[model samples]
Target: MKPLTPRLHGFVDYTACGLMLAAPRLLRLSPQARRASYALAGSYLGVSLLTDYPPALRRMIPFPVHGRIELATFPALLLLASETQGRNRIYFLALAGMVAGAYALTDWKADPDA
Candidate 1:
């Protein structure tokens, strides 16, 4: 069974968005990586806020669609990692792994009663 309910996944989504926003400063990433991180954080925040989940500001994107977006992000994260060095590479790789883990554990099914 998937370990993450929609509520839990929402919490993870918001948390990850915050981390992505802060990572550039915290990790002292290269300028290119910093820009990428900020852009990623903004996009991630937008997706989380619009996702059809408990913590969303609006319910435009279905939870399953959000999951697909997340799946699509894995490759992008890996590409960023490949182009970077040192802490930036490590951060992207770690973020990619974290996203993959969350995706693997989350339940993408819509609630029948919702």
Candidate 2:
């Protein structure tokens, strides 16, 4: 069963976007790290805005497809996250793992009606 419903996923998406946008300052990250964090934040926010969810603006893309894109993109995020050191690295790894695992567990292909 999908652990995260579309509504819950929407919450998570917004929360993650905020966290990504704030992490660089919160963690006192390097310039490259800050840029990466900003980029991810922007991308996440953009996707969420365009996603076909209750909170979305344009609703151009289906929510499940957005989830799939997140699933596909997180590994690349992990790779970029590897550039960090110490606790920041651990944080990134943990965040990436949590997101990937969450996406994996959710049934993105399931019928919205059922």
Candidate 3:
């Protein structure tokens, strides 16, 4: 069985979002990479807030659907990482790895409850 419950995953999502929002500044990335980091942070926050999980602001996205979305986005994240260079590449690759690890650990099959 997967190790993370939906509620735990929600916390992880928020934490990752915060890190993404801070990465550009913390990593001293280029302008383009900074913008991309901000965009990714916003998107991650939106998904977390909309997911049907304990920490969400709304219940629009079911837990399993969230998992599916993550799965679908993984390849795109890899592509984005491949297109970047230096710290930008490292940031994107790290984000992708974080997502992959979270996806693997989350108990997506369990009911989403607080």
Candidate 4:
């Protein structure tokens, strides 16, 4: 299948950030899990803001770099999910995996540095 365009990925990034931010409270997770979720949410938002895409708020970081980061982080997210417990964690992890997988398929190189 063809990869997602940068614009679409930008939308995904923003949505994912919102989901991560809300997950801990919505799922009633443990303190540690909650903290992790918050951290991930903040990080995602920061990255999204810095990404050089049409949807980015600030557009400081290059789009290719953002995609590479996304590709790199998925494994860690998977590991984190595997180490955690509860239905909420499982559901979050599953969605994260699917999103990351979709991100990996995106055409990160489509956008130029300029």
lDDT of each: 0.88, 0.77, 0.87, 0.76
User: What does the lDDT read for residue 91 in candidate 4?
Assistant: 50
Q: State the lDDT of candidate 3 residue by residue for 1-114, as single tens digits.
A: 888999999999899888878878888988888888788778888988999998999989999998998777678778888998887888888888988999999888898983
Determine which window of 10 residues in candidate 1 has minimal summed lDDT: 105-114
TM-score of each: 0.94, 0.85, 0.94, 0.83
Q: 1-114 in candidate 4: lDDT tens per residue?
A: 446787888888888888777877787878777777778778878988889888888888888788777777677677777878886568558657866777767886785332
Q: Which 10-residue window in model 3 sums to the lowest lDDT?
A: 69-78
How does model 3 fare in lDDT? 0.87
| Residue-by-residue lDDT tens digits, candidate 2, 18-42 | 8888877888877777787788788
Considering lDDT, which of the candidate structures 2 and 4 is the better prediction for this target? 2
Q: Scored by Cα lDDT, where does model 1 land?
A: 0.88
- The ten-residue window of minimal lDDT in model 2 covers 105-114
Instruction: Provide the RMSD of all predictions against the true structure, rounded to 1 decimal.
Output: 1.5, 2.0, 1.1, 2.5
Query: Model 2 TM-score?
Result: 0.85
Shift of residue 41 alpha carbon in model 3, Å = 1.1
Candidate 4 yields a Cα-based lDDT of: 0.76
Clashing pairs in 2: none
